[model samples]
Target: MPLRPETARQVDALVADAQSAGHVPSLIIGVVRDGALAHLAAAGTQPLPDADLQYRIGSITKTMTAVLVMQERDAGRLALDDPLRRYLPEAAAAGPVTLRQLLGHAGGLQREPDGPWWERSEGVDLAALLAGFSVTKVAHPPHRVWHYSNLAYGLLGGALERVTGTPWAQLTQERILDPLGLHRTTYAATEPFARGYVLHPWHDTLREEPRTDSRAMAPAGQIWSTVTDLARWAAFLADPDPAVLNPTTVDEMCAPVILSDLDAWRGGYGLGIQLTRDGDRVHVGHGGSMPGYVATLAVHRPSRTGVVGFANSYGFRTGGIGPLGHQILTHVLDVEPVPTRPWQPAEAPPPADLAPLTGRWWWMGTSLDVSWDRATGELVGILRGDRVSRYAPEGPDRWRGVSGVENGEVLAVLRDEAGRPAALDVATFVFTRDPDSEP
Candidate 1:
């Protein structure tokens, strides 16, 4: 469904305000719902003629690079826990930094190469970049802290090419971009692209920024995209195309692997994606900045609403691109609320075998409810402290925990000789109907 006229105006107003306040040369914003474009608006210092204009989406390219890595992992070509040294022995100096750590920016690699600024000057080839690797590249011990490293992603992109025998760009094009019909997103800027400009701090002047190809480091942030294509990509991240990536893998990409901010539980880093918490609302996406362009893509997963923002201002000190996207999304959610699905009875009642396990169990004098979910075909356990755990049937009279603290733990159902409920043994902890009863 299209956005209401009034709601659309409000969203446009937000974009216009951001452009004026941030001194952006050009700005474009789009919202997606149900995997379709809901609203799009643009503001520019010059009269805007086209909506398909591209902006360099900086590190946001890492998300796509990460997706390709996950795709390779899914195809059995590689594993997340595989050490970097396994693929490229040159990286042995970094020690046991796994693929997962590199993706999550916990690989302890330096943020950039020790050489002169690669983003400004044309970068060296992948082989030359890798040959210079030394233990000094290991900034912090592997997985000790979150260190944003463009070099790590560059290595990952090269590793992907080495493992697949296909260029990283081609792999991404075939596996992701083309599959999702994001033709507008490309490695180089196309016609009608916005000119990246650095907003002068003191004077009312603008300096054009060069679009340098980071060569091997291109995977870190290289693609040029428009809000239109990005809105589609955002939708893909939320509701993935199974042909490109498994929905489960996409979910893993959105889940936090390490904390980006230690003070507040506000931010974390996932495999390739970035996670943000705004009160109870959780957002998954990434932000990018090139010489003269800044871009952001954010999706409120629960609501299936997303916002994409692009501005042709190099590293502006205003409210930042992520927050702009967040504000637009929040405004859309507030004005155009997604109707909640009304509760309805299940087509069939709970299974007969699950009846005995339905009520309650006691463990260590605490009560836990073991309930069956017909929708998910799993047994859910609710502890007194409200820490809910989900378990799926593993075998006869046995269940395996699938999520929460009990994930991977086993729940063994003990039955009396007459086939009556007696006690449940979970990870050696016994739970019975009577708290005082012995195992």
Candidate 2:
């Protein structure tokens, strides 16, 4: 009743593959669907068969921190748009950086100031960490682009402490971990912590390393948790409990704020969350990576499916956990695979002879090349340099795609004073036509 028959087999195969490749000393995977946990599997050893321990969850800590901030906001203690200086005056002189900017990684702060603390220092007090930020310069104009910064969250942790008159770690436990009944999850410094491990480059050997304490950057990454505990966290993300954070606020946290096109794994970043669309359904969650551990938690809200995967070894790389988790969810839901075609705006008819609508349009910073089929008197919209779709006129300036995923999707064309197609607003994407484009 927990997992679909085939899904259990698929998970078994994945764990076996990881074991054979020595990618992970141990792994724990959990899947939840329709408000209930479907499966929880643990394989391998915590410390090579001698120690039974859980792994550090690296950057996944940020997601928990983000949730705490939202909880405070829900209680009317603070606002997301409040300037960092509003909470901590030390940041006032830096510039106009807001808590929203910090959460979305748009604060223009460096990824990690004072060098990599994971490799360098044991731990630093909040005051010492904030002191180093004085000389830290902005990398870009605020909110101009997406730049992952651990330090920004670190500063956010300080802001929370200043606002609440408590330490970041305590605030998280009181606000999130404790209320959620995440008994097995706690700060890395807690008792029964798992020793971190790194895989040697040359041979099939894993070396146990001292666990790095990120007290100063605790907001960025500093939490230890087991797979079982993460399963509950994933469930909360998929269908939030209003007592914690309102469902709408959770959705807003997972909504896209910036586009990440720098790599093959292109997606959007929300407030401490990542947004990736799998066909019509959007997956929301976040991934974590530290020196010796990698973890990913994602949820398909529409399907009420969530996956949490954790690895013990540091060098273990599985591309990204989000896609893998999504694949598992699809398999469970029996959903068809997502096509590689990029989403495009709907098409519209030309006002006169199908001439006025034949042009390029930009929608939400994405362009869709549109042309008129003179012979058929239809409109075609091409997306992502490929994937052709045809549209038939439905109304004055609205058209509906006849085939493909865009089929049945409506398009509304915007016109300037001259009555020419200047912009196109599709179901959700907005497109602005190229000026020089001719019909």
Candidate 3:
């Protein structure tokens, strides 16, 4: 279904405002919910920005590289902790850095390759990239900090080639773009692509930016995409398909491994993905930039909703490109929130074993409730009425927490002299039938 007329107007207004403020040649924005594009709008064009028109996604390409890396991990080709030298034995300088460190941008490699800014200049091949690697090439020690290294991703692509004997671009097409049906995404600019430009600070004149093939650094930021394709990618990040990539693996990729914003902690880096705190909601996504293009893709996972925005100008003075997607998507959510469905009775009764554990128990003078989710057939543990954890029955008298505070913890059932259920040992905290019972 399309957005309401008033809501569409609001979205258009937001994009138009951003385009005017940023003074970009053109801008396009798209929003998705529940794996579907809910809204698509463009500003700065007379007719309208076509959803299929391509725009440089820049470092957003890193997200796809990360997914490909995760796919190799899921297939058991290598472990995340394996050192880079395990695959590329030639890089003695980057030998000690692990795949996990590179994925999380904590390997302390320099921010870019050893040439004249790979983003603006013609990219060198893997051999040239690796040949420059030396002990002094490292800016900081491994695992020192989240350094945002494009060079890391370039190395990842090279490592993948060694492991699979296939090129990075072809591997990506086979594993991701084709699987996801993202026909609009490609390694280079195609027809109907937006022309990138650098916005003049004082005047409104714009200078066209050169287009270069990032041969080796392509994994870092070298793809061209459209709002439509980006919206789909955003949805994939929010709710991934088990066929293309495991949802658990996606979760691992989104987990904050290091803080990029340091003390502020407003922004963090996961395994190639980026996490940002916007008010109470934390968004999982990545931002991209090259010489003349800026783009962003963000998803509010809880809502299964995401936003994508692109600007065809570099160094946007108004700073709209950074927050444009979030602002537009949040506004859409605010006006047209995802409708809630009424609760329905479970298909079957709670398991008989749940009877003994159901209802309220006392834990250090506080109440803990154990309930069964018939829909998922998992145990829902609520502490003091609010903190919730979901558990799966592990074995006899044992339940393992799958989420929340009890994650990875086991809840064991204690029995009395007569073999009657007595107390609960959750995360090593004793919960008893009586408030005053001693551990």
Put down candidate 3 lDDT per residue, 106-192, tens digits, no spaces: 998888888697999998999999995787767778888778889899999999999999999999899999999999999999988
Clashes of 1: 1
TM-score of 1: 0.89
The TM-score values for the models, in the order shown, are: 0.89, 0.72, 0.94
Least lDDT summed over 10 consecutive residues: which range in candidate 3?
41-50
Task: Kindly list the per-residue Cα lDDT of model 1 for residues 1-439, writing each as its tens digit.
Answer: 6799999998889878878888887888888998998888888764372458788889899999999999899999999999999998888898999999999999999999768887777877778888878998999998899999999999999899889998888887888888899989998898878888887898858898898878888889989988788989999988988988999889889888899899998899999999988877888999998888889999987778999878888865578777888888878888888977899877876888887888889987888888888988898988886989899998998999988778899988999999987888888988999977765
Tell me the deviation in Å of residue 392 in model 1.
2.2
Tens-place lDDT per residue, model 2, 260-317, is 6557445788888877766666778888877777777878876677887777666555
Q: Which portions of model 3 miss their true places by more than 4 Å? A: 1-5, 46-48, 417-419
Model 2 residue 286 lDDT score:
80
Candidate 2 vs candidate 3: which has greater TM-score? 3
Q: What's the C-alpha lDDT at position 391 in model 1?
A: 94
Which candidate model has the greater TM-score, 1 or 2?
1
The deviation in Å at residue 306 for candidate 3 is 1.1
